[model samples]
Target chain A: MNAISSFTASLPGACAQGLIWGIMALGVFLTFRVLNTSDLTVDGSIATGGAACIMLIRSGVPAWTAALAAACCGMLAGLVTGLLHTRCRIPAILSGILTQLALYSVNLRIMGSKANQPVSVDKYSLMLSQRYVRAAGLSNPIPLLVMIISALIGLAYYFFGTEIGCAVRATGNNRVMARAQGIDTDRATILGLIVANGLVAFSGALLSQYQGFADVNMGRGAIVIGLAAVIIGEVVFGKLLALNFALRMSSVVFGAIVYYIVLQLVLALGLNTNDLKLISAVIVAAFLTLPNMKGGDRDA
Target chain B: MLEMIDVCKTFNPGTVNEKVALDRLSLRLEEGDFVTVIGGNGAGKSTCLNAVAGSFAVDSGKILLGGVDITHMPAHVRAKYLGRVFQDPMMGTAPDMWIEENLALAARRGKKRGLKWSISERERAEYRELLAPLGLGLENRLQTKVGLLSGGQRQALTLVMATLKKPQLLLLDEHTAALDPKTAAVVLELSDRVVQEHSLTTMMVTHNMRDALAHGNRLIMMDEGRVKLDVRGEEKKKLTVRDLLEVFEI
Candidate 1:
């Protein structure tokens, strides 16, 4: 009974964390599902965002400006990866790995060569904080997270409906057709990477504010978590949300929430915290295999 | 409207696998000429069309389109004046996109694509009118994904897209090669109608001798990366598959 109560108490905190990570998953979805490229840069870009945001806040920058600046820094990282892939002729996965590996040193520099840094909500005004997780009215983080997610989804929907966005989609769907139709596919790919990493860093910025600290390893295994959210969203809400792009994105956030809730339940059941990464891997692997199993059934 | 002057291209130069794909190939087209190209494998029929489409830069010589030199233009930049249909049915259209969306993309081929909505109400109506005449029942299924369409249907749609904006030059690189015989015939007929309607300067490459003889006003047979036979007017009208076979010794 004590364990059950504790698990229930952790649900709100888990939901808030899931929502924060959902933004990162949306970034992953842009590359993994939309652009048909698996980008591993999120692992480092997320930490870069956290480190940049915390450092900027410590320097007396406003929290919102710091977050935006962090996102811009993330975009620069994506630009390097894009140039490496398109100009230098590096393979897509390899380019992402290279950028991620390089960002480790860059992230350490951003945090003043320290492994971790903390930002106190009492010392600096944060956009959102864990102290407000269960607070009533406007101070509660859930409503603000929901509002921010809705705005992001709205912006994304509008962007994708535009002509330039259609070109990006075409570039993703068929490069030959896109080029034949006069779209510079290389430019489109670079633009997509820039936008995807910006969102990832923004998520990391909010996460650091919520947790009150930025660590060099904060973003380790981030790509796996993001992929887990994406796969879980597709397998669970694919049928219901497949037709509408906005709904599909919303499903991804819900998938993240479900993942955290499950994690909270497991932890409440006496699971070791260090085994969390193993559990995440298992979950993602299971979900990834589900579609292939269905395909096999059809083949047989 | 189109000219390739002494264009040459070689693959794997300085290597044991060196192969000369285009050897000083020279060709010219009048403003409204419908030229059919036929050749054996490695005879550079498709290579010639690709050269005109700016798929690769030639080692020497210039490509002039509408009296403007475009030898150094990249493929996507040169696409402003060219409409291309590839041999593979899957190569010309985005399978995951809707039919109407594909048409919208084609409509803005040579134009700048800004933040404007991808498909307008006016353009949607125009696309419906354009697709209705195909008799493929595609007009009513504008929202259907292109991947769900058959090979013939996709080829037909690609033909429509290629002609939608009335390009300065239309390139049909064995556009009907992958379809069944009946579908091939249907696509051929559609291609002819669209070409005649627009009076588009076209270069169609085909392996079928009968198709080569039946369709275009001009016929050119390629051999060893150069034009071996150029027939037109009464001479082309009088020529048969037997004459072509005898000339090429196929």
Candidate 2:
């Protein structure tokens, strides 16, 4: 009974964290599913966003402006990765890895050579914070996060229906067809990576504000977590929400929440927190193999 | 309407697998001319067509399309004036997109793509009219994904896409090679109708000698990266598969 109450108390906070990470998952979906490239830059860019945001806030920038600026920084990171992949002729995954490795030093520099920085809500007037997570009315983070996600989804749906967005989609689907149709495929690819990393950094900015601190290692293994959210969302809500683009994106958010809920449950069951990364790896691997196992059954 | 002046291209120069794909090959197409290209394996038939389509740069040559020098233009920039259909049906269309969506993409081939909605109601009606004549029932299946269609249907859709906006030149590189004979004949007939309807300057490459003789007004046979025979008008009308075989020394 005691453990159950403790788990219930933690549920709201878990949900809030899930929503923040959902934005990052949406970014992952853009590269992994839509653009058909597995970009590892998010692992570094997320931290860059956090570092940039917290430092800006510390230096007296407005919270919203700092977040936007952080997102732009992430776009720059993505541009580097795009140039490496398209212009330098490096492979996509390798390009991401190189950018991610380089961003470690860049991230540290952004944080004024510190590995960690904290922005107390009391001092900085943050947009959202964990302190008011379970509070009622306007103070609750859930409603605000929902509103932000809805706006993002609406923008994405509208943009994708437009001519430029369709060109980007075609670039991902078939390069030969895209070129034949007169699309600058390399330009389209660069634009996609730029937008994807921007979203990832924006999410990181929000997460830093919520947790009241930014750590250099906060974004470690971020790609796996983002992939977990996307795959879990598809596996659980894919058929039910396969109606439109908005619903599909919402499913990714819900998937992130479910992942956090599961994580909280296991933690409450007395599992050592040190093994959290191991558990995450196991969960992702199991989910990744599920579809292949079904296909193997047919072959057998 | 199109000119290739002494274009030369070599694949993997100085390597063991080096090949001279085009060796000072030159060809010109008059407006409204429909030419069929025939050649054997390694005869540079497709390579010549690709060179015109800007698939690769010629090592040393000039390509002029409609009086503009486009020898250095990239493939996508060159695509503003040229339409292409490939040997593989899968190469010409986006499989995962809707049929109407695919047509909408082709409709904006040479135009600037902006923030405007991709498929307007007017364009939808236009695409429907275009698909109706194919007799493939694709007009009713506008929302269906192209991947679900058969190979023959895709090739037909690709043909319509290539001609959606009248191109300065059309390049068909053995587009029907992978289809069954009956489907190939249907697509070929459709191709003839569309080309005639638009009076398009078209170059069709095929391995089948009979198809080469039957479709277009002019025929050219390529051997070792150069045109060996250029027959047209009265001479092309009297030529047969026997005459072509004699030229091949088979």
Candidate 3:
């Protein structure tokens, strides 16, 4: 009964975390799989979203409203990085570093008094099902219920089908060709960053509210988690190379679910919380090597 | 309606390995010009196209297209006025994208307000009509991934894509050079059909002297990054392989 109860307790938050991280997982999919470049702004921007949302909600903004604001802020951060890379001609990895560095100060400002927000849940985050429960005057597991109801999946489907989304996906595959076809690779990069970081920020917004507090370190190790979920998704569900946009998206979502399950196992194995980053690093490192190993060698 | 004024480009400008890809090269293309360019390897034929395509910012020069100064433009900005097909068939179209999706992207040239993306009924009708001219039965494969197409088919499709918007200039960077001989001939014929049908001002660069002579209303021979011999009108219409060889001193 204790084991079953403990597992149940962890379910909502873990699942919510997976859904939230699913946003970043899809974002990382753009840089890693789609854009065919690496952008690390996700690490800081995820936190940037949390900090921005926490501060906003504390100022009396609605929960999902704060989340939307955070997503916008995340998009701006990503825009800076995309501009640095595309306009300034800086390499993609270096551009991400520059944006990540600049965001550090911005995130601190968002935390306001140097401490993260601890706004009353008032019924969990606005996105959590508790808000719906409050409206309905009934008992409900807000997180699980809200996850199914949110625009997360539907919005993803819609965005990936747009003309701009087609152009963005093509940019990941080959920027030069996309541009030659007048797809405007620079614009695509900027938009991809905006969408990517927006998703991450949305995740952060939901995460902060669900946990009942927003911490400065909540975004730590987020990239590892996103990548693990993405790679695990590619592994277990097979690759999405030939699949349509919707299937590819659902694949990444599944990847995020499996990744958290694996993460939970690590906790069950008696690993310390501090060692989690190390474990994540090891997992990412292992997955990164899989592509190289499978392909034999393909340079240029 | 295209011109290059004293265009110059030097890679590794200050280094010993520096190469003057274009040196004071000048050329003019009248409206409806279909200039066939031919030269040996490292003769700066591709560089000339690159300069016009905005693939590289020339060290010193002015490229004007349709009376607009585009020399300062980068590749993507100049793409509006220019349609390009690369030597690598894979470089011309997005492989993972469907045929219609790729066509939709091409169709976006010179237009705006792209509301997210909804391929309207009119757009679908337009795409089908556009593919019908290719005659490869590709109109039936609108949803098929471009990656699965043959090199010849892709190249033929690229020809359709480059001319889709009827840009100010079309750059065929040895587009069919990557295909096998039979496939190359088929693509070349398709290129002729599309260019003629659209009446597009086109530039085709090739190493085949026969192809150069066999196609286009105008012919240019480049040497050491400069247009050494340009023949057009009646003279170009009467060009022979031997005459081109004499011009190249081959």
Q: Count the backbone clashes (under 3 Å) in each candidate.
A: 0, 0, 4
How much is the lDDT of residue A250 in candidate 3?
66
Q: How does model 1 score on DockQ?
A: 0.86
Report fnat, model 2.
0.82
Cα-based TM-score, every candidate: 0.97, 0.97, 0.90
What local lDDT score does residue B118 receive in model 3, on the 0 to 100 scale?
A: 41
Better of 2 and 3 by DockQ: 2
lDDT of all predictions, in order shown? 0.91, 0.92, 0.79
Q: Which prediction has more favorable lDDT, 2 or 3? A: 2
The fraction of correct interface contacts reproduced by each prediction comes to 0.82, 0.82, 0.65
- State the lDDT of candidate 1 residue by residue for A1-300, as single tens digits: 988999999999999999999999999988887788889899999999999999999999999999999999989888888899999989999999999999999999999999999999999999899988977888777888899999998998888888999898899999999999998888888988988999999999999999999999999999998998988898889976445778888888988998899889989999999999998898889988987787566654
Identify the superior model by TM-score, candidate 2 or candidate 3: 2
DockQ winner, 1 or 3:
1
Q: Candidate 2 lDDT, tens digit per residue, A133-196?
A: 9899887888989899889989988988899999988899989999999999999999999999
Query: All predictions: root-mean-square deviation over Cα?
Result: 1.6, 1.6, 3.2
